[model samples]
Target: MPHVTFIEHNGTAHTVEAVIGKSLMEAAVDNSVPGIDADCGGACACATCHVFVAPEWEAKTGTRNEAEVAMLNFAAEVKPNSRLSCQIEITAAHDGLVVHMPDGQH
Candidate 1:
């Protein structure tokens, strides 16, 4: 399992153990982490799972696919580091990934 860190808008951080091969959105929702709604259920239709990938972890997480990029256009407070959690697949390389949730996601 990989350990994922989710940083909240209030500067709170929650770390959860996520199983590899599952989507980041799935892990967050399963752990009851605040901020990721995943309203589209891992499909690229919704941006409720929007998150900001930590600067240092960006390369490890990789760039967004075309579908995710399009969906992000509808997300609030989009940034250079913005990503949809449903689009991120957990892997060994993402063992310590950290993502920051936007204030509005809650």
Candidate 2:
């Protein structure tokens, strides 16, 4: 299992343990975390799962794929670190990863 820390726009943080190999969007939605809708059901078509990767964890999470990059363009308040959570698969190396939800996601 890997732990993911989701930081809300207001700075509230919720840490949840998730199974490795599952997408980050699944983990957040399963844990009832606010801000991640995962409206497209883990597909790259929707940007509802958009999140900002924490600066320190950016490298670990890696860059977005072409599909994610295109979808992110439609996400609210997109930033350089923006990523679609559905595209982020959890792994042992991703343990303790932190991400921030955008205010508009609600």
What residue pairs clash in candidate 2, if any at all? none
Candidate 2's C-alpha runs over 4 A off are none
Residue 95 error for model 1, in Å? Answer: 1.2
| Backbone clash tally (model 2) | 0
Give lDDT tens digits, candidate 2, residues 35-97: 888878988998999899989998888899999988888776998999999898899999999
* Decoy 1 TM-score against native: 0.95
Give all TM-scores, in the order shown. Answer: 0.95, 0.95
The Cα error of candidate 1 at residue 87, in Å, is: 0.6
State the lDDT of candidate 1 residue by residue for 43-74, as single tens digits.
87989999999999998888999998888887
Candidate that would win on TM-score: 1
User: Model 1 segments beyond 4 Å from truth?
Assistant: none
